[model samples]
Target chain A: MYAFNYHRPASLAEAARLLASNPEAKLLAGGQTYIPTLKQRLARPSDVIDIGGLAELKGITEEAGGVTIGAAVRHAEVAGSALVRRLIPALASLAEGIGDPQVRNRGTLGGSIANNDPAADYPAAVVGLGATVRTSKGRAIAGDAFFTGMFETALEPDEIVTAVHFPKPEKAAYAKFPNPASRYAIVGVFLAKTASGIRVAVTGAAPCVFRATALEQALAASWSAASIDSVTIDPSNLNSDIHAQADYRAHLVKVMAKRALAAAG
Target chain B: MRISMTVNGRAVSGEVEPRTLLVEFLRNQLGLTGTHVGCDTSQCGCCVVHVDGVSAKSCTMLAVQADGCSVTTIEGLAQGGKLHPLQQAFHEHHGLQCGFCTPGMIMSAADLLQRNPDPTEHEVREWLEGNLCRCTGYHNIVKAILAAAQTMRGMAKAAE
Candidate 1:
């Protein structure tokens, strides 16, 4: 890991100030991904601001008929939170299935979405549930617009995510075919019946999490697993790697969508 | 940066580079080699330790981040010169062959028993997903953890 200056700010404003001052500064949330990236020398930053200790970004609250989770809250905390379990059991279960026990203990929702790994699970939940991400700059970015591409997000260089607001869905479930070693999704699908309409989000199959409009339309019409039987996913836009071929991921997407729909029931 | 923390019920302080991992600090600075580094890629749980009573991969955590937090390593498990119940169970069950992953397995199991005292066999196996036993002695490891859970439950009842 490259030697860098570490800063632990007392407030979000201070952290933002440090970021604005140091153009190459990176925010360290959970360090689950950042630390590994550093160890691999994938990134060299002039400064690292630790936000894990920020009191302002550390709570789970019920607000406006949904749940607002602090950006720094760990995956294990979300998986174990009674509030999350009661309000959005699907999200809790999604959190539970992320990585493994130790990774879940330190990985944060904000960090996971910010890193925006193509195989990450949170992006599916964010986009499927139509959640809102609040930033330190006081911007609420829709989940659909938050992720730009693999390892990319809509966040500005100095913008820090403060919280994520997941509105209560009528029903939601996530299913994934995980890689046995990394536990990352080879092809994952999140199905949600929201106030707006039926939504289907697929991850680990593309450069970014995307809505399966065909599956959404079919589920909206019939709300049954069989409704998506005729809907075919194109393999051209999907990711193909050693874990699975693009065509195989395309097939798993439909299978997982069906599984998620069944689980939502 | 100078960081201070409680390790094994003793206060310790050290000056570490910003890039210093907690595992490195424990092993190099403090000379606590009980926590081994297997993969160093965060895939293996060889560096499992309790920070503030919750298990985390020390190799993935920065030493500076552990400041003001209480850390419990595998070396801290014994009390009054007696092995922890999990340790005793592992010894009796021959849970290890090379003993390379034993510390991490024991620490991970300790955290599991703290949360779920009476874990089923499946739960024990699932909870140990992060831990890797290269010797392929997972059957005996699971057995030991289950047996230790029972013994710990009995000890709790005896105290009651």
Candidate 2:
């Protein structure tokens, strides 16, 4: 990795000031993806701000039938949180299944969503559960609006993601057919039954995680795995690679959606 | 940048480049070579270590990030010249052939045992996902961890 200045700010205000001042600075949260990118010389930031030490950005709070997770809260913490287990067990399971134990120990929810890797699991949860991303700018972006494209998000360079608020659902579950080597979702699906209606989000099969409206509508009509058997997912815009072709991912999306529905119950 | 951290119960400080990895700092700077770096990528767990009492991929973490933190490498496992129970179990069960992945395998297993004292065989397999053992089919490695867990549990019971 190339040499860069490192700054560890203890407060959110200090972090905001640092980022605003250093236009080429990048916030380092968990460093799971950032560190690897740096090692490969894929990115060159003038300064790397370490936000892991900021106490205000590290926790999980359960209140009013929902959970608010701090940006710096690690995936392992989410997986082990008793409050999350009791409130949203599906979310906990998704956290538990990310990467591996060592990776989970350091990967943070904020970093995961901010990076917006098409294959990441958290995006599916955020969009599927209709969660809210709170920023340091005092604005909350809905999950659907937060993700822009592959490795892209609505967050500005200086805007720090403070927390993610996930409203507890009646029932929700996520299922993924992971690539064996990378453990990234090949065609992951997150299905949720909310007060508003049924929400189905699909990840890894496209440039960005998206809502499967047809499957959601089918499942809303009949909450069964077989309900979406006739829904043919369009593969034209999905991702294609050596691991899986677009057509195969389209097929896996349907299979995973059904599995997620079965698991949500 | 100058950073300070507690490694293996010793307060260590060093001036390093911000890009230096924790594994590189331990192996090259501090001469704590027990922590191996099998893969530069985070996929292999050969560089696994305990940072603030949780298993983390050392290669993926910058040395500056570990400032003021408590770190425990495989070298820190044994106490008073005696091998840690996991080390003893691995020795008895023939858990390794090349021994390249032993340090990391032991560290990951130790972390698992810290959180779940009595892990089932299936649980052990699940927890070892981060650790990759290419030499042996992970059969003996799993046996070694289970045996170590049993011994540790028995020791705790006796103490109680």
lDDT of 1 at A2: 93
How does residue A163 of candidate 2 score in lDDT? 96
Candidate 2 residue-wise lDDT, A6-54, digit = tens: 9998799999999999999999999999999999999999999999768
List model 1 lDDT by residue over B33-134, tens digit each: 999999979988999999999999999999999999999999999999999999999999999999999999999999999999999999999999899988
DockQ of 2: 0.90
- Candidate 2 RMSD computed on C-alpha atoms after optimal superposition onto the true structure: 0.8
lDDT of 1 by residue, A160-258 (tens): 999999999999999999999999999999999999999899989999999999999988889887898989889999988889999999999999998
Regions of candidate 2 where Cα sits further than 4 Å from its true position = none
lDDT of 2 at B126: 90
Task: Provide chain B's TM-score, model 1.
Answer: 0.99
Model 1: clashing residue pairs? none
TM-score of each prediction: 0.99, 0.99
**Per-residue lDDT tens digits of candidate 2, residues B19-94?**
9999999999999999999878888799999999999999999998999999999999999999999999999999
